[model samples]
Target: MKIAIIGGGPGGYVAAIKAAQMGAEVVLIEKEYIGGTCLNTGCIPTKVLLHSTEIYHQLRNEAEDLGLEINDLKVNWRNLLTRKELVATQLVEGVKNILRTMNVEVVRGYAKFTSTKTIEVSLTAGGKRSISFDKAIVATGSKSIIIPVPGHDLEGVITSREAMSLEEIPESICIVGGGVIGVEFANIYSNLGTQITIIEMLPELVANMDQEIVNSLEEALLTKGVKVYKSAKVLRIDRSGKELQVTAQLGDDPFQVIAEKVIMATGRKPSGDGLGLEEIGVKVDRGAIQVDRLFKTDVDNIYAIGDCTGGVQLAHVASASGLMVAELIMGERMAMDFRTIPYCVYTNPELASVGLTERDAVMKGYKIKVGKFPMYGNGKSVITGNVRGMVKIIADENTGEVLGVHIAGNSATELIASGAVAMRLEATVQELITTIYAHPTVGEAIHEAAESVFGRAIHIP
Candidate 1:
């Protein structure tokens, strides 16, 4: 069996490897560098910058409290950029090596479907090649959305990609949109001593996340001297002598923010254009490629996954879908269980969630009970000096089945996996409470939160 995968991203690469492992001849085509935006520009690069800034932030803010004395701490932007590039390059090379080991043919080019089973590649090095395959997978992924506003094309306005590779930290920055991308950049630059102003059109930042956890994050940002403007709309951007002026509307009032640079982190849209998907009888709806439950496109032998499908614009989600599609193509029946997928935000006090939120549970007509345990009550949180958030668990009131787990604190991203596992197995709150959690560990907070649902928590009054 011959398989052709487009877009060498998390989705495409994983599918290629799995299909190869399943004894299919695979060809992976990429226009740009491997590892896609998640590695080259988005997730990995941003995390690298965030990690450096986090260390700097900790030393600058907590050194005195922890009985350490340091002087004249500053950021070396060039060195940081170099390290980010190094990390990304190493990972990209690792992916390439793995693809080679799996014997997946990786073609460097731009791919467009000439027919249901044929893809014409305009090679990056200059010529065109035609690839004929028994099956094809589209994992084109997405790109940052640039809002259509006046003066957006000015020299100082930029996107998340540009924000990651900035030559130096700007004196100040105005970030539009307070979603994951915007809030993360705000956290990064703010910790690095760059004045940050986040303007979110929503009533609250990271509106998709649990609001209580978001409250903690917002509080953390406020404590860091980051200005937040909620329920605001950007009118335009204008130049003002070495700086950029952002005009916005807050309800009935006009608000303005002046900054050295402007970052447009509104969101991302599916990048399914130029692939000739529709020409091949595949449905394209508002830039997103439409796919069925098995990720099969309208064309019987063609499949679409990841950001192109516009289901969840998460790397792990894309990878999972890729794996599932590969199994299906190889004559194995596999299904994607999205309910257990964890959503994470890498902030000072990280945020993570699995399953339904309190609001969603109630809306779905489930009688629920909620339990929360503050991080300050956890010994590890206090020992680690990261007692700023809590663990919230929502369960079915009658059945005691754990419906959702939301966390905000140190290692929250890592800790949320336990919750994902529990939900995946349909574990109840009683089961979680009965589970042993080590003393002086942050995970104990999960246990206490589960106990709190029964009003029998020992850690709190």
Candidate 2:
């Protein structure tokens, strides 16, 4: 079978590789760089900066407590950015080599659907080419949303894409939208000595995260001198001299902040333009391509995944969907399940969650019992002097079934995977408690949290 996968992102590339491994002829098309926004501008690059800033923050603030003397603790922005670029390039090339090894042909071009099984590619180099396939997978991802506002096109106004590769760090920046992107960038810049003011249209930051964890993160950001303005709407961006003035409204009051740069971390929308999807009768909801559980579109031979499908705008989710689609095409019994997928945010005090949140479980009419263990009590957290968060476990009250796990602290992103596995295996709180955890480790908080669910936590009074 000849399979054409559009957009060589996590989803498209994984789909291509999986199909090729299944003895299918696969060709992947990408318009911009491989690995998509996640690698090029979004997840990887941001984390690189975050990681660097974290070390800088530790050296500057915690060095004295650690009994270390440093005369000149400074950040080389250029060198840090260079390292980020090198790492991204290496990973992109690694993905390319893997695809090559799998014998999947990769074409650099923008693919537009000419028919259900045919696509015309406007090559990045020059000219155009058309490919006919027995099956097609649309993984064309998403782009940063640019809201229509007065003076939005003014100089010094940019998106997350531009924020990643800034030539010089802005003295001050006003970031609009306090979602994951906004909060992460605020953490990054604030630690790097950039004055940060986050404006969110909602009542809270990271509205999708556990409210308790969100509160902890918000407090942490404020403690770091990052200003947060929730329930505020940005009215306009006006260039004033070398700075940008951002006018915002909160309730009936209007205020403004002048900064060296203004970033629209508002959100992202599916990038499905020029695909001729409508003409080909592929269903599109809002800006996202609609797909069933198997990632099948209205057209039987075509499927869609990734941010373009709009179920979850996460790279790992996209890759998982791609694998499921490949298995479906290969006549395997498979379906995409998102119930226990992990969500991670790599800030200083990271936030991670898996399975149903407390609110979701309550809304679904489940009688849930919750256990929360403070990180300050964890031996490792106390030893490391980084204990400003906690772990929360939600379980079925009667059955003791692990329902959800939320964490906010050091290595929380890494620790959330255990929650995914526990939920996937339908493990009970008893099982988690019985499984011995290593002493003097942050992960022991998870074990303690499960024990706390039944008021049997040994470490806690």
Candidate 3:
């Protein structure tokens, strides 16, 4: 079978490689660059910067706590950005090499669907070609949403893409949304000694999240001197002189906040722009390409995945969806299972979770018990002087099956894989309690949290 995969994100490229390995001739059409936004702008770039900022902050601020002394700690923005660019470039080349090694015909062009079965490719090299494929996968991802507030077209207003690739760190920044991207950048810049003010239209940061988690994060943000204002709507942006004046709803009248730079992190929507999926009868719901349970679109032999499908705009979700579509097209039966996909927010005391939250369980009418362990009670957390978070787990009170796990503190994300698997396998809290956790490690916090559900917490009541 001949297959064409459009967009070279984690979803698109993976789908291409998998289909090739399955003994099908695969062609990948990428109009811009391969590896798409996840590698170039979204996931990998931000994470790389986050890690760098983390190291800078740790060495400058926490070195004293760790018994290391340094004076005049400074951040070199030029060198740091160069390093980020180097890492991103290396990864991009690595992806191109992988595609070449996989024998997936890499077409540098825009893919336009002329019909359900035929797509016209306009080459970036100034030519046109036509390709007919038995199956096609569309993994074109999403882009950041910029609101239509006035003066948005001005000079200092930019999206997350521009924010991540900043020429130099802005002296002061006002992030226009308090969602994942906004909050993460807030934490990063705040730690790096840049003035940050986060404005959220919702009542809480990560408002769609569990209130407890948001409370903890809000506390941390407040402690870090981040000016967080929620339940506020941005009215307009007026560029005056060297500053961008943000006029937001201040109850009755308007209030003004002027900043050196402004980041728009309202949300992300499907980026099917200029791909020509509509020119061929492929249906897109509110700019997102709609897909079925098997990752198939309304058009037969066509598939859509990742942010384009609009379920969860996560890198892992896209990767899994791409792989599933590949397997499905390879004459194999595969279903996308999202029972316990882990989600993370990289913050000071990182937030991580899998499966349902306590509120989610209750709203769904599940009678559940909860277990919680504060990092202050953990030997490792106290010893390392990172005692600023907790481990929370929810489970069915009657059956003891684990319902969800949420953690904040060092390596919270890494600790969640076990929780995800346990949730998937329906492991009970009792089983968690029985599991041996090595002392003086974050892993033990998981076990201790489980012990809390039954009112037998060793470290805390």
Off by over 4 Å in 2: none
Candidate 3 Cα errors over 4 Å, as ranges: none
Q: Which portions of model 1 miss their true places by more than 4 Å? A: none
Return model 2's CA RMSD, one decimal: 1.0
C-alpha TM-scores of all predictions: 0.99, 0.98, 0.97
User: What's the best-to-worst order under lDDT?
Assistant: 1, 2, 3
lDDT of 3 by residue, 281-326 (tens): 6778777887787878778889999998877888888888888889
Please tell me which model should have the higher lDDT, number 2 or number 3. 2
**Model 2: per-residue lDDT, tens digit, 298-324?**
899999999998778899999998999
The TM-score ranking, best first, is 1, 2, 3
lDDT of 1 at 189: 96
User: Scored by CA lDDT, what does every candidate get?
Assistant: 0.94, 0.90, 0.86
